[model samples]
Target: MSTRGGGPDRRGVRAKVEAQRAAERRAERRRRVLLAAGAVVVVGGIVAVIVVNFPSSSSSSGLGPEGMALQTGPQLASVSSAASGQTVDGISCDSSEQVAYHIHSHLAVYVNGQQHSIPYGVGVVEPVPSTVNGGTFVSASQCYYWLHTHAQDGIIHVESPSQKQYTLGQFFDIWKQPLSTGQVGPASGHVTAYVNGKAFTGDPRTITLQPHEDIQLDVGTPVVPPQSVDWSHAQL
Candidate 1:
């Protein structure tokens, strides 16, 4: 009879111990879940911060070939005479980049279906070493023409002291290159001109350098079609 009574007590104790252990296991699982959720939140926040802080250089809605990106090919020409602070076509070269009437335009050239790049420092004189906002050393020029370029991206920066009309002819003159319906730079043949993906019927030189305008010139046979570029992400 005593053995029977002791058996019930032992079984009851064993059941209680099992119940307590089950509760502890549940608590541990809950802790692990909470920790995992916290880690996910932290990682998500970091990704959001990175996305907001650093944007992509290329645009999602960009057109034409990806080769249109800046510095994709060899430079077309060196800096023209305007780089020496000489006045060309009434445009002056100042001691610094002017921002009073800042604007940007793009130009592209193709010879026999092959693309050529426009060089940086086209109208800037004597590039010097300087640090940018990110503490990166880059070539900064001593003088800047009203029409200039800071990269080999075919972007013509029109940073003038005053707002006024400028034309492709003036820029070419500043570049010390010749442009006409018959010729462009060193390449000579039947010249085809395009403005904003449309054939420009008038003198190619007379094409105005408007803000965000895309200009292209094709030389010789196998004239390439007008190409477009994504200016949406340009920092000009």
Candidate 2:
């Protein structure tokens, strides 16, 4: 009887040991599963961030109204001013599919083809300084942000293919110039220009332009004299 009772107690102890071992195995598996899941989530989050900031070829940010227009022929530059005594429509910006306004470093703001009141000299965009120093870097997407520091006089200017142009002081009117997509030539994007006090104008200097394109003002010589070829019936 003592041996039989001892046998039953021994069996119970063995069974308890087996149960503990089984429970520990299950706990380990659960820990491993949780770790794997955590790693997957971390990797997935990183991929999502890369997709958001840098879109793949499958994505596009969509073009503005000017960008959507069908371009036909050589491009010319456009200009507008609040004090020019001409309304936005006078510059054909109201119904123009190519109207672009430069307000500071921002472009594509007025792509709606509607003439909006913009403060003159209040906000203007300029080209990178490297371009003026015989650099071939054209202002991207019709607008640009330029960086330059001068101890003495610093001014921004605009010149069109027709040799029409304007000069802007640091605290003066905002200058806007439209670039035509129609023009076909080098120096097409920007006329080689430099900064000077004298305003420039003359015969229609050849410049390359695309439909609905505009370049902001910067300190550079108006390589193209910026004069209107046909002011009476001109679409300048």
Candidate 3:
């Protein structure tokens, strides 16, 4: 009778040990899983940082404003400015769009008195806005941003939904061109500016783009009168 009772007790102890070992195995598996998940999280964060800091494909190639590629030429060289102006939100184009029913603005650039072209493309939109510069003109649902260029009028068509103060400095940024206190494009000299025929007192880059406003930037010698934009019918 004593031997039989001892055998039963010994079997129960063995079962308890087996259960404890199983519990420890489960705990070990969970810890390994947690470690793997933490490693994945760290790797994902690093990738996101790289994408944000690097230039996007569209902007990387100097393409901006109405699908026009920033034309590199003998006189023009790529330059960056420390002055980043207030960016007016870009929007789709509209046939009936206007600065208001009655207000708009213009921009002009001159180097050595001769008018420097404000380039071809400034504020342009397409069906696939991001792929606009990828070539192939997209019309139909085409749009326009606050600052845009049409033809060689040297005008920045600030056709917005309402009347809000815009800046010449912002216009330059949209054009993907360079402008500063004493430099416009490849031309570097004393910079002079005018607003509605009145000489600007402060930095030329900060000139206000009010409705029917005419802004001019002149670099180097020969400061001719800024070509006037006849507001008589100027509605863009």
lDDT of each: 0.76, 0.29, 0.59
- Of 1 and 2, the candidate ahead on lDDT is 1
State the number of backbone clashes in model 3: 6
Candidate 2 Cα deviation (angstroms), residue 213? 3.3
For residues 52-145, what per-residue lDDT tens digits would candidate 2 score against the true structure?
8876633322221111112222222222231232222222111111213221111111111221222212122232222221112223222321
Stretches > 4 Å off in candidate 2: 1-6, 57-211, 214-236
Better lDDT candidate (2, 3): 3
> Candidate 2: minimum summed lDDT over ten consecutive residues — where?
147-156
**Residue-level lDDT tens digits of model 1 in 1-236:** 24376587788888999999999999999999999999999999999998888765343322222223554555566664444777888888878778999888899998778888777667777755343322212244567788876666688888999999999888888788888988887677888999999999788999998988999999887989988787764555
Ranking by lDDT: 1, 3, 2
lDDT of 3 by residue, 6-44 (tens): 587778888899999999999999999999999999998
What's the lDDT for candidate 2? 0.29
TM-score winner between candidates 2 and 3: 3
- Where does candidate 3 stray beyond 4 Å? 1-102, 126-143, 233-236
